[model samples]
Target: MSETNSQQNINTAVTLLERYAEGKRNFSEANLGNADLQGVDLKGSDFSYADLNEANLNGANLRGCDLSFANLSQANLQDADLRGALLFSADLRQADLKGAKLEKADCDRSTHFPQDFDPAQVGLQIKDG
Candidate 1:
């Protein structure tokens, strides 16, 4: 995507998130496909069931964010901090999670990880709970 387009997308996402925080708008299942949200501070944001397919989330600080059931297929999440984030049932197929931090992230059967990914490399420990 072009620089202008990327900026526009980021602006739109920020606006939407601000609206959601203030209760001015509701994006319960909004489609944010292919948006560039790199380096954004979206901590504690609610993105449950949102369509985030192919979104660029590199270096984003998403600690404690709610992403339950969100579609994150092919999303760029490299080096993103997702500690304590709620990612239950989130679709992560083909997503680039290289060097991402997922400590304490909620994962289940529906959560998808790359085929050759080492959970320990990303600080993820699969426990039998």
Candidate 2:
């Protein structure tokens, strides 16, 4: 990820998560690239078109969330609950999706994936353009 936005993303991630505790949701287009958000319960939040490259979102509860077109390349998304989430055109190349619950998640051919990863094998629904 680019370091230009990394510093701001650090503070944003912390403050954002803190606010989430107080019931704040809509975080669309946030500059959270390279943020460390591991194990956060951000279910049902909006993260569309956000710059989340290399973010540590491991074990996060992201069920029913909107992540369409978000940049998640190289992110640590291990064990994350992404069931029924929107992932259309999301860049997920090299992301660690091991054990993530992708059942019913919507993605399109524009969504990037790891070389060996198969969205169909993981129960992700292919969205038509």
Candidate 3:
């Protein structure tokens, strides 16, 4: 990433963290790639089109979050609450979803998965358009 882009990312992460601390949870299209946000309470946040690849989101409260088109590849989402999350077209390749609660989360054919990953086994529903 360019230095400018890197700086922008840092600023965005800090802003999001501050807003989260102030009880603001709507963060649509936020660029949070590679950020360490483990154990954060972000329920109902809108993360659509956000780049969360390689981020540590373990144990975060992401229920009802809009994660459609987000890049979550290689992210640690273990034990995260993802119920009702919109994951259509999201890149989840190599993401650690072990023990994650994905019940009723929306995914579709456009959603990429890691090798041997099974959404159905984890109660993730496939939404057909």
Candidate 4:
């Protein structure tokens, strides 16, 4: 990434953290690449179109969040609760979803998964038009 983009990401991450600390959870269109947001309780937040590549979100509560079109590539989502989350068209390539709860979470053909990763095996459902 370019230096300006990196600075933007850092700014976004700081803003997100500050908002979360201030009891704000609606973080739509956030740029949080490579951010360390592990174990945060962000349930029902809007993260659509966010850049979360390589972010450490292990054990985060993401249930019912809107993550559509987000870039979650290489993110650590181990043990995260993502039940009913909207992940349609999200990029999950190379992401670690071990033990994650994705029951009723929505995805579509446009959603990208890691190589050989089975969405069905992890309870991720395809969204109907």
Angstrom error of the Cα, residue 98, model 3: value is 0.9
User: Sorted by TM-score, highest first, which candidate order results?
Assistant: 2, 3, 4, 1
- Every model: Cα RMSD to truth: 7.0, 4.9, 4.1, 4.5
Instruction: Give candidate 1 misplaced runs (Cα > 4 Å).
Output: 1-11, 20-27, 125-129
Error of 2 at 101 (Å): 1.0
Candidate 3 per-residue lDDT over residues 1-129, each given as its tens digit: 554343234325567778778776656556787888899888887787788989999999999999999899999999999999999999999899988999999999999988999999999999888
Model 2 scores worst on lDDT over the 10 consecutive residues at: 2-11
Candidate 1 residue lDDT tens string, 31-120: 778888898777777777788899899999888887888898999999999998877778888899987889887777667777887665
CA-lDDT, candidates in order = 0.75, 0.87, 0.85, 0.85
- Candidate 2 is scored at a TM of 0.88
Better of 1 and 2 by TM-score: 2
Off by over 4 Å in 4: 1-14
Q: Output the number of the lDDT-best candidate.
A: 2
How well does each candidate superpose onto the true structure, as a TM-score?
0.77, 0.88, 0.86, 0.85
Clash count, one per candidate: 0, 0, 0, 0
Q: Please provide, for model 4 over 13-95, each residue's C-alpha lDDT reduced to its tens digit, 9 standing for 90 to 100.
A: 56676767777666666778898878888888888888899999999999999999999999999999999999999999989
RMSD of 3: 4.1
Candidate 4 lDDT for residue 109 = 91
lDDT (C-alpha) at residue 126 in model 2: 97
| Candidate 2 error regions (>4 Å) | 1-11
Off by over 4 Å in 3: 1-12
